[model samples]
Target chain A: MSHLHSLKRHLVARYGAIIAITVLLLEGLCMFAIRSYYVNTIEQVLSNRVQLTADYYQKYVPGVTPLARAQKLLSSVDKDEVALVEVLDLQGQPVLDSDGFIADYRHTTPEVSAALNGQQHAWVGKSPLTGEKILAVAAPLCRDESRDTVGVLRYSVSLEQTFRVIQRLYIYCLLVGLIVIALVLALCYSLACRILLPIEDLTIAAKRLGAGAHDVRVRQRSQDELGQLAATFNYMSSQLDAAERAKNEFLSSISHELRTPLTSIKGWSETLFSGKLVDKPNQTQLGLEIICEETDRMIGLVEDLLDYSRLQVGHITLSLETVEINDLVTEVYQQLTIRLSERHIGLTLDLQQQLPLVEADDDRLKQVLLILLDNALKFTPPDGLISIRTRFEQDIVITVADTGPGIAPEDLPFIKNKFYKGNSKLPGSGLGLSIAQNIVQLHKGRLEIASPATGGTTVDICLPQSTPWTAGTYNWTSKANSTRQNLS
Target chain B: MAKVLVLDDEIRIRGFIVVNLESNGFEVVEAASGEEALRIAHTQPDIQIALLDIMLPGIDGIEVCRELRQSYPAMGIIMLTAKEQEQDKVSGLEAGADDYVVKPFSPNELIARVNALLRRVTLVEQVSSSSEELICDPFVLCVSEYKLYKGEKSIAMTPTELAVMEVLLKRSGKAVSRDELLDAVWGPDYFGDPKIVDVNIRRIRRKIEDDPSRPFYIETVWGHGYRWHGESLA
Candidate 1:
């Protein structure tokens, strides 16, 4: 669930950032284009009007003085269309002004000077009289049939109306762009959420599955890649649920089967040991030993099944403490030496001296060692050599090798599966290797089994010199400590 | 020899217990189911104790124990339970069983429990004949009746609790160690934990004392055992 929440947040942030940036860029470009187009159109209109007036003055004004021609043109032009109009002569002195004749007035504007030099020019400046921004254009007046510059004609228009139009255009474009951006953001948000909804569902279902709710499944809502993933998740959970049920059923039945015999055996043994069968000395002696051996076997089987079940359900806890590997090996060897002797098997121990103390669950590690030794005792023939060897490398490695008939290639792989009883003639529950492997794994160690065709089987257990502390390990240790305190 | 009713679904286990009980001088009656056990119990009026297996086909041992307690209030009941079904033992006790023995238990332990219960029965009979009731102020112990009265309210107790209270009331104002109480109640041959006495004492105090922790009648002699305050009511 937390994973799903974080994924939703990440998707929203990434898509939202992209959409916002794209909208901003597009709005900026549109505003610039609109402003430039409006300004350029106004400037072009003013320039064209100035040229047309100059041509009309040159053509229709019939041999009059330059001042008289300028006055006639200015009187004909509309004042609302053009703010200021002036006529200048070749000597850079103002010939006529729309405001009226002024004494010693000179038109020294850059556009007027450029026009007198036979160039058409446009300028934007603040009007000297009105103090408003204005666009001005100046055109050269030429003599008829000579094309020589005679006077300059200038026309200027206030830019306030044009600016107001541009401002309105800017606001309109921004409104449309904002609406489109909001729509796009909403679409993108919904699309992203729709795209991630199935994945989020799968994540939540997977969490439930991991927490042992095996029946949980994701709903496939669409025929997309995410839908396929959801389908796969559902299939996996169903498989897990089936496997769990099968295992539980197997364990329950096996426990019932194992306990029934154990109950009878233990009951009769206690009955006989309670001196009820004391009349026959020899028979009682043999019966007592048989009872003892069978009871031990039953106990071994029960412990193995319990250990496997605990490992399966993740209930196995370890009490970690420093342990000398050599000492531990020697102790296991001593505990099993009697059994090995009873089977008439020769034993050898090759342990390294002064081995370092490895952090592990001492009792669980010993259980692993005993399981290996017991297996070796069972498989090895009389007068066969059984070697218990230890090496101090990067890790502590302990190997129990037996001179027994090697496991068949076909049976080797399934040997560690619980209740996979290979060679039914061999009297054992087949949980030995699996339990040992689980115990070794709990200590952050590894167990390997190798059997050769030449009649030997070797089991190696490698344990790390030190294990890092984890939350799981801490919880197990604390639980173990509390149990110990209760016992004390 | 006391007549003991043994009920178990497993024939072999039932046979084993019957043999063990018979050899130990108890007259044993065997029944395979709750219905059969009830029938035998009703027909045999002399049945003094019952050993019931908790798991049965029709009615479980707990139900049978409850039914038997209603019918025969004086009959001693011991439940036989599997080791894993510990909850059954507590339910058995609540249903009026006096004690429980886990299955696959040693034959000697079973025999010892039966003998101890019958011994307590005989002791109660003897006490009733000697005295109707033993009174130690606000508390009254009717030995023959197997009941304790606090003020005017009578409180029913299990056989184990009754035995322990009887021993303490007999020697009121004197400290009796846990070992002495266990010997008197569970018997000298009882190989169980001595903590059994402490448990029964706590049960008795819960029933008769206003405050079990600061017990008014059953006072704890530190490091020794319990003593009953023997001041009589005016």
Candidate 2:
């Protein structure tokens, strides 16, 4: 609103000044033309009168006395015509006046003396008698036989009426110029407002949205480009609103997820340290068991977060190796034997002895295996059936299926998205599936999940047999070194 | 022994609470969800306290607190919540929870807060046998039945609110300091926040006083405590 209002100021300065100056110039030109036209008409009429009177005198009045000729010309002048008639002697003295008075010729104009010297001339100035603006023309009279000038014929007309008309034209031009300036100012102001008002609204809305007032939306006025911009602003604002909501929800869920175990561990440690359970040996043992299990849960959460961070920055790399799938499966099964027996879940593994060695990272493969088995154990109730198998048909395939409650159809599509823990209440950091997909993709493999109609889920990991290909290397954790030692 | 219901989705934390309470001379009952807790509360009418965790799978603890308060106004409720969920704490308190213990709290702080709330919200039949009933204008206190009546109609109040009203009525027309009220309602050795007294008094006034905003029966002495204007009749 101040002078910093650049749009309005720009419009008025760039075009408004131009229009104002053009109008002023046209008005000035019009006034000048009118004044000059009136004055020129007066001069032309006076010159024509003097020339005609001179010719008449050359034929008839040259030989008469100068006084008698001046009298005769004054008397012959028509009363209705505006031009005044005067006759002058050879000495530039007035011999006859149309107003019927003879007075000072000491202030004689050059045109009068030049006419007496046998020439013709005209002058425009104030009349010596009444001080009225006038145009005067003078010419010499001659006889055809002698060829010498005898007297001068002069005609003068007052220009007051012509100047009055020109002054009126100037006033009219001035009024028109003022009106034009006002119109131009109004036009510039409207044009600037039309372009800038919506933009200002968008700016304010965008600022509020940036400040985390995510539900803000700009007002849309027209179907023009600015209106489209406003629509986009509104759309973007809603998207930010949803994202902020999701982020907060995730924070709250993550906060609860992290705090529960911390509470258990902290509570157990405090209980154990108090030695109040010292006499109750079973309670003390139970406290120590909970502390260790909660510590392990914390470790898993940290590992998932760390892996996700590394994966996001494109830093995860696989140390490719020739590996036996059955051996890896057996090792993972051995790792989970205690957990499986605790839940009384039965496992059936069918390993293909002729399976080809696939190029993969052993440590990462172990992590994916652990994630699948852990998910199975968490979801499956006691005495449920769990099965694992490996087969080869152009690619090595491994499937881990659990007799557990299958995922909802709506939730299956987004199950692999990062931090997308859809209304499921299981107790993991929601990054395991996403990380598993990334790991499989790094190995040129595919991960597929399916929920059969018999109320269970099956996950398939298909690893393509690499043709001993090599291209690039990235820095990864040093667990590859330990795996290499074991394989050797 | 005091009987308490421990409701939590996490098995380990629930065990911790149960063990702590059991060793401190309390009988413990456990429920894994809001549905189970409500079921247990319906079956067992004598449970004196319920310790609820705010975050659970089926239904949140605040809803449970509301339902419990609606049905059993005298039951003492305590919320166990994470420290970062500050809004949950306020909502829990507004849902008629007597106190809250932030997660990762020391065993001593947890027990102390729990015991302080238990004292205010529990009826201990150890009053002197001298006065069987106390009477004031339009109000009657039945010490034998542990009830209050306004013009022959009983006013439903939580144990904590009734205890505060009883203290103010006992020392009618005398300014009782906040500390003095705290020691009377809670035990003398109870080291906890005194703000619980104000919350209880407000709840009590809402039930008895016509306008809780401008209280007349119980007057607050500026920079001190409350004074009851009634003359006690026993």
Candidate 3:
């Protein structure tokens, strides 16, 4: 039943109904007008015929009997036009009949009686002689020049033929109307199909797209609204496909990256556990060192991945405070000094005498500084120069510059994107730069990288200057310290 | 001592393998890239085996294995692959690697594989020196020359394949159990799966038989092992 209701809602039902109603109303009006004209013309022609018969009887057969005159008049008139003629006396008694017989003597029609009173009259009624419905007209007849009525002359014509023609015409109009409605319905069905087919195709394509069939597209050749809609859908699907590919690539790379450190740790632990190095103290010491270092690398990788996931979910909370920029830089540099020296890279710190304190997370700022320094160390060759400098401008700017092979121009833009590793052969997980950038942004600071054409890279971290401490802020910090102590 | 080439891009891993292999009384040569590995293989004829890492800086391990297999058919090749990459192990084997040791593997497992491969090489060499050649119908095994010939065509075989063929032919018309073949080819000290015997047998059949599926010389003995069907020549 619902299927039928929907079918009726289509163009066939909607447009066809309008066309059918209009045709029906026009057909009815045409039939009514034709019927009125037919009846009126027939009545007028019968009245005139009756008057001519009365005149002829007075002029040509003055001495004849009234019955003979009536008979003569009916015989002379056309049978198709005038079906009956009658002559009645002043008392409304029929004297003559055109059929040469009378069924009743006192059955004079009202028109015939009115004619006997010397008034011409016409009416639409049944003929008494023929018993058929007809239009009859009656007129009075006088003798010589006297106005006294001699008898009444009446004429009537059958209405059956006019009614039959009108009925046949009505049937033709009905048939024509039906054909036109059928044609309109067929056109409407095709028109509805033309509009609905593309929409159906788009629905199927959208389902496939949702199912991860990213290459699915609808064919749209026309420059209409649906075509434009299809074009937009295609563009969106392509974008999703690219994003999915990038995600898969990142997952594979990250897995490989995570596995490398694991391999080292496992290999070294197994080596040391095998009891082969027990007799040699120095080898044992070296083995233990490698095991510890590889373990640290693995832990760092895990922490980096965890931080990236937390940042993705917007779950990172910072303990913000006023941190001296010089202190933060010095702490990170001191931690990385031994590692840099191992690579034969020199670290030079150029700190301004009066560097302003910045409002930021001190731990998170140290993390960013360490990430930048570690990246520079990994890329720089032996005996390379790395400089850490702090200066005060609109913001407290801390720059770490190294004489290393700088990033390629094309890879510079996407370096900060999560899991975007420009070179797969590198040892670190690709989330380092993105994580550092996120932390800096959380502090409302900006981090920028510049790779000079000559050959070196520099990373600049700018933090907003801290507002002067007030008594209220001091109380807030004390309360925060108490909360931290309680949690620990 | 047998010379072995250890190829890995990581200095620490290379150092670990060198220390372990050297402690086991094998001379080790290290190469950081595939190109260096190929150069060393070309120059050092005495190097009997190579432990190649699958992930290298240039010309990855699979390609290196293919190249080295073409140049030195007698040399043993063991691929060092990451445990999670199953496809790498299969591809390495398909590229003519004799065996594979997954990364994060125990040093004992690595040493055992190296010893097993080297033992097979030593056994084949001893067999070749003892007898100049071993013959079966339509095939000739030149033991001392380390070559095999079927009619006029020369067949290439790894050291493990040669050792298995030597054992099977010496005990002709006798079914050799997989364990016995493993003992004769890999030595008594080797602790590994006996399936290694089946893998070598399959490789040997592909090189020697016209139809490896139905071998004329080597035949399976129901539940036992392989039998040398030399009765066809009689």
Candidate 4:
């Protein structure tokens, strides 16, 4: 049952309207062939009978009376049962008749008149006397070799014999055509299904991957396009599996690293508060200070882990708020001023005055900028130039450039990947750029990485300037809508 | 001082509980395991309240509660669970626990629940005195000393038990919430298990009636808490 359903689905998907049109085309071609064969055969048989009667007349009674000559010719030919032959005049009168017209001759038929007018013609119609279908053939008669018209020769044969032959041929052709069409359909369906089966497998594998099955692969092994697709799909699955394994290891290591410090901090803090360490005041104070520092470390590690996890699970819920983008950038700069000054990194802020408030999650944006700036500071050596530039070019563009060793062409592509620590010789969790990328994506923004011709990497953040502030309001007008637009 | 049984695996938690209860005028008997708890429950069958930790080593706290409830029907059983999940509370209550407290709970709150359960039970026991004017199931209360009499015999009840009975009689056939009782008896600052109301009700029923399983005057209302029926009052 399922096979039948899938076959129906396959036909609907692959064959569709093309099959219907092809069947109609084949049917039309078969009908034309059958009709042509029947008409050609009838004309050949009719002309043969006509020629034989004309021959009999010329040979049996060549110089005799036209009436008796025709009569004798008709009797001899009619005796053979080939046809009922008659001779008619121009005035709708039968001058000579074999079997006395046989009650089957119709004077009003086109074939009769055309014969009397010295024109050769043949047609199929119903006989008036027998009420049977017949084919009538009419040919003009000329005396000897002269072109003058005399009486006309009209001969008709019952179409039952020709029809019987045609009916048999038709049934045979129909049976053969149907068998051929069925074979073609079967072949087409099999070919379509073979091509689509691997695609269906790949679709299922993609769904499984989305559902967290990192090892899902399309394992079809034919050396066709679909097979190559399956091979590529398997490769992707392996890469994902490796990445997932590494992520799990990173999480485990981070958990252990954070938990050790947290355990010490919580244990010691509680002991000190409970007066267990009252005898060693100086040691207790130092322990308390160390606990505070470890707590901050734990917080930072947990924040990084959370950002990474959120990105992995695609569950970073953004609570967008309206804020001055310049103000936010300035605040981040001020917060990192000491570190920037220590590294002698120059901060350049070119803000468009009275710029419209940007709609974003301020905290997340700050985090992204902080990560980018930290990257810049780490990569740039002390006393080297680090420039943070902001502009409103078709959008709000923020670029952080540093004077450092340029990234290798190969490493540039994977710089934003989790745990991808490039040649900075700096110790980092390697989650900074990845988290920034995720946050930027969450805001529906873009992050571009450009390496200068000489050295250093320049990272640009672009956000849309024109956004709908309200249901029917633009960002520049209506302060209320501006608030909402900035929130977006 | 009322005899209280404390069961917990953690020594510090037990120590804190004992110190708090003792300071609040409760003579606490400590036990580390369910077996030890059962031994204590057997030796001191008159222990007013048994605080059993659900995650005890040997026979867990639910079993201990069941044993205590079977043997000493008047003893208040309050199970201690680590989390405040509904299933845990429901199961603990269904397993014949009069009340439950989620840890790490404040020692002061635990002591409050213990004191409330004791006071409520003693009041019900004391309410079974003479005075046929106020008829409540198989017990009669002497309105003068707030004493109770059950089948011509005087039954001892705590002051809180008498107050609860008085409130129920005043608003007979009405359902009351734990918050209402805490306001009326333990004052508004009472921050303890709301299951204290169930514990008190169970204790009161045991003291005044022949069978607490089929409580006549004080009836359970299932999910909405408890109700007192005037029709059940003799």
TM-score leader: 2
Tens-digit per-residue lDDT, A1-488, candidate 1: 57656777777777777877888798889888887787788778878788888888777766478777777878877776655777788866777777876437665667877998999998877766568878888899876767899888887778888888888988888888788778876887787778788877877787788888979988998888888888888899898998897577556445544554454466557767678657756645654565565578678777777778777766677777778888888898887788778878989999988776687787888888888887787778899989999998888899999998878889899788776656533446677788888888777789989998887999989887765554224534334445765698
The parts of candidate 4 lying over 4 Å away from their true place are A1-19, A33-44, A79-84, A88-95, A99-135, A139-152, A157-488, B124-189, B193-227, B231-234
Report the Cα lDDT for residue B46, model 3.
86
Report the lDDT tens digits of candidate 3 across residue range A352-402: 978877777778889898899888988888999999999988988999999
Give the CA lDDT, 0 to 100, for residue B206 in model 4: 85
DockQ score for model 4: 0.01
| CAPRI docking class of candidate 4 | incorrect
Taking all chains together, each candidate's TM-score versus the true structure is 0.58, 0.78, 0.72, 0.47
Interface RMSD of 4: 11.0
Model 1: fraction of native contacts? 0.22
Native interface contact recovery, all models:
0.22, 0.68, 0.46, 0.00
Ranking by lDDT: 2, 3, 1, 4
Model 3 ranges with Cα > 4 A deviation: A1-251, A324-327, A348-357, A389-397, A450-455, A462-488, B130-151, B160-234
User: Model 2, range A1-488, lDDT digits (tens) per residue?
Assistant: 35337767888788889999999999888888888888887788788878887777777563367777777767767777777777877776778778887756743877887887778988888977779987889898777678798777788887788778778888888998999999999998888888889888887787787786977988898899999999988898888888788678767667777888999988888877877798999989999999999989888888888998777665676776777889999888887887788879987787989788877798899888888877778788899988888999878998999999977788899888777777877788888888988888777789999986678889999998756444223323345444654588
Q: Which stretches of candidate 1 lie over 4 Å from their true place?
A: A1-13, A44-48, A90-94, A101-133, A142-148, A160-256, A277-488, B131-141, B148-156, B164-234
Model 3 per-residue lDDT at A188: 82
The per-prediction CA RMSD against the true structure, in angstroms, equals: 16.1, 6.1, 7.1, 17.4
Taking the tens digit of each residue's C-alpha lDDT, what string does model 1 give over B85-195? 446656777677767776667777888898888888667767778867778767788876678888889887666677888788888878899889878787788875465
lDDT minimum window of 10 residues, candidate 3 chain A: A470-479
